[model samples]
Each structure stands twice: as C-alpha cells, then as structure tokens.
Target: MAVTITEVVLRDGLQDEPVVVAVADRVAIAEALVAAGLREIEAGSFVNPRRVPQMAGAEELFRQLPNPRTVRYSALALNARGVEHAVAAGVKQVNLVTSASQGHSRANAGRGVEEALRDLEPVVAAHPSVTFTAGISTAFVCPFDGEIAPEALLAVARRFAELGITRIGLADTLGTAEPEQVVRSLGVVRHELPDVDFSLHLHNAHGRALDTVDAAVELGVTRFDSAAGGYGGCPFAPGAHGNIATEELVAHLHARGVPTGVDEDALADAVTTVRVALARGRSL
Candidate 1:
C-alpha cells in the first residue's frame, strides 16, 4: 500500500524563515512536488503576514498555485477570519490548529480549548467545499504544560468528530515525542475515533521523527506531513525544526519496502532547488 505525503513547505516551512522567498519559487516548489507525484500540499496560511512575513501573499499564492485541483492544496487557519480568507482564496482544505493544553492553546490561539472549539463550528459551516482539519498541537507534550495525557488528546479528537470535522491531525509542535509515545497517543484516538481519517504533523527537533513515523505506521496510520529539505520551524514553538523532510520520509518508507509513489530523483531535485533558492536570496 502507498502512504500519502503532504508537503508543508508553503505553510509550516515558510513560517520561521528569515529570508522571503519569491512567489515564483513557491510555485516552483509546489509544481516540482506535484510533478514528483505528491497528491497533497499545504500551500500556505491565512494568518497575519505581520506575524509571519514569509507568508505575506497567501491569497495570491493560491491563485498562482499550479494545478490545484489535480492535487489537494491546503492551508492553516487560526480562526473564523482565517477560514474566511482561505475560502476566499480558493483553498480546498483548511486546517485549524489549537492545543490540548489550555496554556498552550491560549498562548498560540488566544483562547482556551472550549473557545477554540466554539469558533470551529462557524468556520466549518461557512466553507462546505473546504475540508476542515482540527490539528491538536502539542499532542504529545507541551512546552508550558508538559506531558499531556492521552485523555487530553482523545477529548479534543472526540469533540472535533462531534463537530463534523472530517480530518484530524496530531501535531508534535515541540518535538517532545518518542516512537512509543507516538504510537500510544495516536492509538488511543484511533481506537476511540476509528472512523476519523487522521494525519500526523511531526517536527524533527529531537531527531526522532522517523522513529515516530515507524511507530505510527505500525498502528496503521498511512498519512503524514512533511517539508522539503527539512526546512521549517514553528514560529510559536521555540527551538523546533520545520518538519520531517518529504524526501527523507519517502526514502525511509521506500527502503522499508513501502510504496510511496514518489520519484526519488525528483525529490532530490526539490531539495537542491530549495537550497539554491535560499542561497540566491528568496524568502517565502
């Protein structure tokens, strides 16, 4: 069976960069990844550009994105306003992220868990074409709260399910996760929410992302989120790398006899293209 890969270069990867990449470069990266057979890409975010200047022209980015219908293009949103921007910009999927921990949720989303869920109803109801994904940040552990329980994440997942959210993603925002932890955390939700299609958004801050993938795979999780050249770090979470590299994860799965349908040479080219673009002066 083939595992699905979602490239996060445009959203998560660009959020923490110091240099701004040109729109052409963004298009190039998206085109190359699609050409390499990636079916889903998180194209950009509708968040405030002042906070993440690297993603200044997200609406235009969606308009300029190549063959968006051929491959699913997604964006991250913090609230109803961001969801409105995503719908206006023509994104087919929008991800709403919060945390299981109240402290982290307040710091990142400016609301407690209950308030975040309350905002999600309008966001989901307003955009029927756009698939809504609730990403529970710091699903494993929190910088402020530390060692979040499995019950905490399960509660969030159940609420999203009740709210008619079609997709759910568990984010290791701070990278404080091991393989067993990954399996256990996701296993709990998978057992409880067997009908929910789930994905994992991982960071390589601890260099254990691949191992976490292994654990997730063992639990029958097939969808994963990654970035090119390992580029990206959470702007809100300090000291975290962007995400698992698409090339690296594809290569890992391929080596383990898992079919991912990604062209190895094409993935390498994406890494080179990103490095060269950054070297030549481009941000975004």
Candidate 2:
C-alpha cells in the first residue's frame, strides 16, 4: 500500500508549545521535512497570535517557504477571517477545522458544530482555486464530551462533502480512542462517503496510535498526519499529548512493506532539527 504522510511539525506540533518558534526555524523544519520526502506539510494556522503565540508568525513562515512546487504546504483556518488571511498570504491549500463533538467545537472554535460549519461555507465558496480539506477534530472521542457516535462524525463528513470539500481528515484529538473504535468509525465514514479521501490524525497520549494506524491501513487509508519528534498537544483538549511521531509512523509503515516514500535517515535528521529548535526556543 502507498501512503502520503503530511508532516505537522511546523503547525499542530508547535501550536501548544510554551516557547514560540521563530519563522526561520519553522521554515527550516519544513524544508527538512520536504527533504525527508514529505509531499504534504501543514505549515501553520492562520489564527490570532494572542490565542496561539507559537503560530504568531505563520504568514511569515509561509511567505518565506522555498520550493513551493515540490511540496504542498497547507495552513489551518478556523474561521472566515482565518481563511481570508490564508488566501491573502498566498496559501495554496487550507485545512478547515471543526470538532465533531459540540462541546469540543464550542471550546476549540468558539461555536457549535453547525455554526462552525456555516462559517466555513463562504470560505470554501470564495477560494475556488485553493484546495480545501475538512478536518473533523474529536472524531473519535472528546475530552469535554465523551465518545462521539459514528453518526455524528459521518454527519460532519457529509457536510464537508456537501460544501465541495472532497478531502477529509478525522482527528483523534484527545488520543483516547482504541483500535476497535477507530475501525468502526472509519468504516462508517468510508461507507457513507466513498468518494472522499480520508486521512487519520492521531495523538499518542494513550500509546495506541500505532494500533489505530494498523487498523486504518487495514481499511485502506493511505494518508496520515504526523509530527516530528512527537511534539504537540491541544490547549483546549485536556490530557491530550503530542501527535504520533513521524519517524515512528514511517518506520512502522516501512516494516509493514507499505511505500510511504519517506527516507528514514533524512526524516530522523528532520526530527532532530525540530527537537533542537524547540529546545533552543525554550532556553531563550
């Protein structure tokens, strides 16, 4: 099986960090990931600096990125203003995020699920040229609200499809989901939206991320979102930890004879660079 791994070290990986990484460092990290054979990278979120200080220089980071044609660089946008900022910043791709659970949606996006979906309508309509991927956070479980039903996730997936967003990512925001649950939920979504491509965004909080990956691959999911050196967490999702390590995910895929197209050695170097950058930022 072949898979496309989207490196998130520059965005979700650093969103909750105590020390904000410099734009130069973010760009360097992104370049390294591309060198490591990552074709897709989530550069940053177009959000308020006050809320997510680590992502304060997202525009600069995107503006300074080199070799734009080789890799697909994307940013996350929670609202219409964020989408506008991303569009103005020349972002070619954007991830529209909203939680599957209402409580988590309200906390993370400051609105209910339906309200947030309504907010994304115009953003999608306005950006016909830029690729948009809908990310349904807390698809498996929500910290504020317990295990979300599969129907709830499918509903959000349907909405994304209705909005002409064909690519969708299901996020285990709190990392509390088990393999069985992941399989069942993904199966339902896949059955309902057969045409939409699906990706898994997992967290390693409970150390079951790989198990979930195994389940996903069995179901023919070929896209995943991972962070370098396992650095990330959600400020709004209590008990959530870093995403599944990129190197670890790559190693697992390679061992299973799945072609991820990522060079393990180069990926390790990228991970080391990310770790060093974060450590250096902390010292300042």
Candidate 3:
C-alpha cells in the first residue's frame, strides 16, 4: 500500500512556535522537504500577520520558493480574504479549514460551522482554477465542546461536497482521540461521504497517533497530514499538541510495507534545520 504524506512543517509546525522564523529560512525548510521526496507541502497560511506572526510573510515566502513541477505546494485559508491572498500569491492549492465543533469554529474562525461554510462558498466559487481541500477541525473531540458526533462531522463534509470540494481532512484538533473513537467516527464519515476522499490529520498528544494511523489505513484511508519532528499545535485549540511526526509516520508505513516515497535521511535533515531555525530565533 502507498500513502500520500503532506509535510506541514512550514505551516502548522511553525504557527504556534515561541519565536517567529525568517521567511528565507521558511523557504529553505520547504525546499528541503521537497528534496526529501515529499510530494505535498503546506507552505503557509494566508492569515493576519497580527494573529500569526510566524506566518507573516506567506506571500513573500511563496514568491521566493522555487516552483517545482512535481511537488504540490498548498496554503491554509480561513476566509475569503485568505483565499484571495493565496490566489494573488500564485498558490495552486489551498486548504480551507473550518471546525466541526461549534465552539471551536467560533474560537478559530470567529464563526459557527454553518457560517464559516457560508463564508467559504464565495471563496471556492471565485477560485475555480485552484485545487481546494476542505479540513474539518475537532473532528473527534473539542476542548470547549467535548466529543463531537459523527453526524456533525458528516454534515460538515456534505457542505464541502456541495461546494464542489472532493478532498477532506478530518483533524483530531486537540489530540485526544483513541483508535476506537477514530475508527467509529471515520467509519461513519467515510460511509456517509463515499464520494469524498478523506484524510487524517492526527496529533500525538497521547502517543496513540500511530495506533490511529494503523486503524485508518486498515479502513482504507491513504492520505495523512504530518509535521517534521512532531512540531505543531493549534494556538486556538486549548491543550492541543504537535502533529504526528512525519519521520515516525513514514517509518511506520515503510516497516509495514506501505511506501511513502520520502527519503528518511533527507527528512531528518529538514527536521534538524527546522529545530535549528527555531532555536536560533529563540536565542535572538
């Protein structure tokens, strides 16, 4: 079996870091990930610099990075303005995110799930040329809203489908989901949204991300979102932790004979570069 691992180190990994990394270093990290054989990379989020200082120079960073033909670089967008920014920056792909849990939606996007979806309608309609992947945060548990029902997740997926978005990433936003919980919810969503290509965005807060991954693969999911060195968390989701480490996920997949097309040595180098850059930023 083969899986697509989307390297999120440049976007999700740095968003919550203590220090802001320079744009040049960010582009270097992105290039290194591509060199490591990653096919998809979430380059940055087109958000307010005041809200996420680490992702301030998203447009400039995109401008400086080399546009390779093989790798698909993507940016995160929360609203219409963000979609516009991504389009203006020449982003070919965008991940538009909303929360399944209402409380989380309010906190993260300042709107409820339905409202956020409504806001994204125009963004999606306007960007017909750009590939859009819809992500539902707190697909399992929410820090503010408790366990989310599978129906709620499916509802969000249906909305995305109606908007002509086929790919969806279900995120364990607070990293509190177990394998059984993941299997139950993902199973329901997959059954309901059979036409949607679903992916998992897991966090390693409880160290059960690998177990969830194993279960998801058995359930026929082949796409996953991960960060190098397990470095990521939602600044808006209380008690959230880093994403599942890209190296660890790749190792697990390879050991199970699931090809990821990523070079482990080069991935380690990219991780080291990210760590060094953050360390340097903190020391400054």
Candidate 4:
C-alpha cells in the first residue's frame, strides 16, 4: 500500500516551540512543504491564542497559505468555537482531538472524555461542509492517568464511529508505547472497526517512534503523522517529545521499499525555514 505522511510541523510541531514564529514565516515554511511534495499539511490550529500563543494567528496564516486548490491544508479544531474559527478561515478539513485518558482530556479540552466526545457530536453535526477526523490523544498512555486500557481506547473510538466518522487517528501522546503494545491495541481496533480507517500520530521521546511505525505498517496502516523538522510535543501531555521526523521516517520507509512520494532535499529547505524562524526569535 502507498504511504501518506501528513506533516504536522506547523501546528503540533510549532505549538510547543519556545519562540513564537510569525505568520509570514509560517506561510514560507508551508510553501516549502508543498514544494517538497507534501500534499497534506496540518497548517495550523484554531484554539485560544492566549492558551497556545504560538498558534495565535492561525486564521491569518491559513489565509496566506499557498496552492489552496492543489494542497490540502488542515487545521486542528479542539471545540465548536475552534471549528467555527477554522470554517471562517476557509479550512475544509478539521482534526477533532479528544484524549482517551480522562486526565489529559480535562487538561487539554477542559472536560472529561465523555464531555469531550459529547461536545464533538454537535460540532460535527453543525459543520456538514467540513470533513472531520477523530483524533484520540494518549491512545496508549497518559502522563497523569497511567496506561490506557484497550477497552478505553475502543470506547473512545466507538463514540466517534457512531458519529459516522470513518477516519480515526490514534496518538501516543507520551511516546511510551512499545511494539507489542502497538500491535495489540491497533490490531483490535482494526478488527472491530473494519470499516473505519486508522492512522498513527507518534512521538520519539523513547527513540522508538520508528519502531512503532514499523509495527503499524506490518498491520497495514499506511497513513502516519510526522513533522518536518522533528519538532513536536504536547503542552498538556508531559514527557512527549518531537514527532518522528518527516525526512527520517521517509528514509526509513524508502529503505524498505515503501513509497511516500516526498523529496528529502526539498524537505530540508522546509525544515531550515522553521529553524531560521526559531533562531530569529520572532513572534506575532
């Protein structure tokens, strides 16, 4: 199966960054990503500017993105308000993230898992023009709540399934999941939800994010989330580090003869743009 890498550097990757990058630089980085053959990019998130100051001008950033008709620029929408903001900015794809762990859910979404899922239903119903992906954060473990049971993960996924959502993204928010743990959880979800499509959003804190990618590929998951410069981490989930770098993951998959359709040399230019932006320490 062909692999699809959704680069999340601008949203998930830059949100946890120290220096806030300006919107103009964000547009430059995104342009480079598209030039590198990234058809899908998590361009930004529509959340509280005060809460995640790094993502302050998301609407403005989306307005300035390149190749609007050809490239898929998605945004993370944490709630109904966020959905509204993204739609207003002309974002057609929305990533609805809810934590599988109740503790992280409250920390990230300011509600328990049930409340978070409950709120998503109306939001999904309200936005028929937008395409939504159900992203379950802390799919394997949570910093505050410990290991998430497989049943817990399935329950969260099933709720989204009932919403008629076909795509589900399982996240290892703490970067603590092992190969065996990956097989068990992902296998069961695929078995039970045969009609539902799945993807992985991994981190490299333990240096095993690639290993999990290998395991997921073994189970036929072709879609994986990555970052251009290996930049990522969760403000709510402690211990989470950068995502599996886009170039690193692409190289690993190519070495094994998997096709990703991304160019590494051009990807480096996108990565450099982020590094240069951080180096400048620019904001707003």
- State each model's CA lDDT, in order: 0.83, 0.90, 0.91, 0.89
Instruction: For candidate 1, give the lDDT of residue 254.
Output: 97
Q: Estimate each model's TM-score.
A: 0.95, 0.98, 0.98, 0.98
The residue-by-residue lDDT of candidate 2 on 160-265, one tens digit each, is 9999888999999888899899999999999999999999999988898999998889888989999999888888888888999999999999999998999999
Candidate 1: 10-residue stretch with minimal lDDT: 275-284
Candidate 2 off by > 4 Å: 282-284
Per residue, candidate 3 scores C-alpha lDDT tens digits across 156-225 of 9999999988999999988989889989988898888789999999998899999999999998899999
Better of 1 and 3 by TM-score: 3
Cα lDDT tens digits for candidate 1, 1-284? 67998888777887777787877888888888887888888988887777778887888889998886688888899888888988888787888877888878877778898898888777687667778877888888887888889999999889889878868989888776887887888888988998898889998877899998887887788899998888887777655666888888999999999998889898888778777666665534
Ranking by lDDT: 3, 2, 4, 1
Clashing pairs in 3: none
Give the Å shift of residue 101 in candidate 3.
0.6
For model 2 the TM-score comes to 0.98
TM-score of predicted model 1?
Answer: 0.95
lDDT of model 4, residue 238 = 81
Clash total of candidate 2: 0
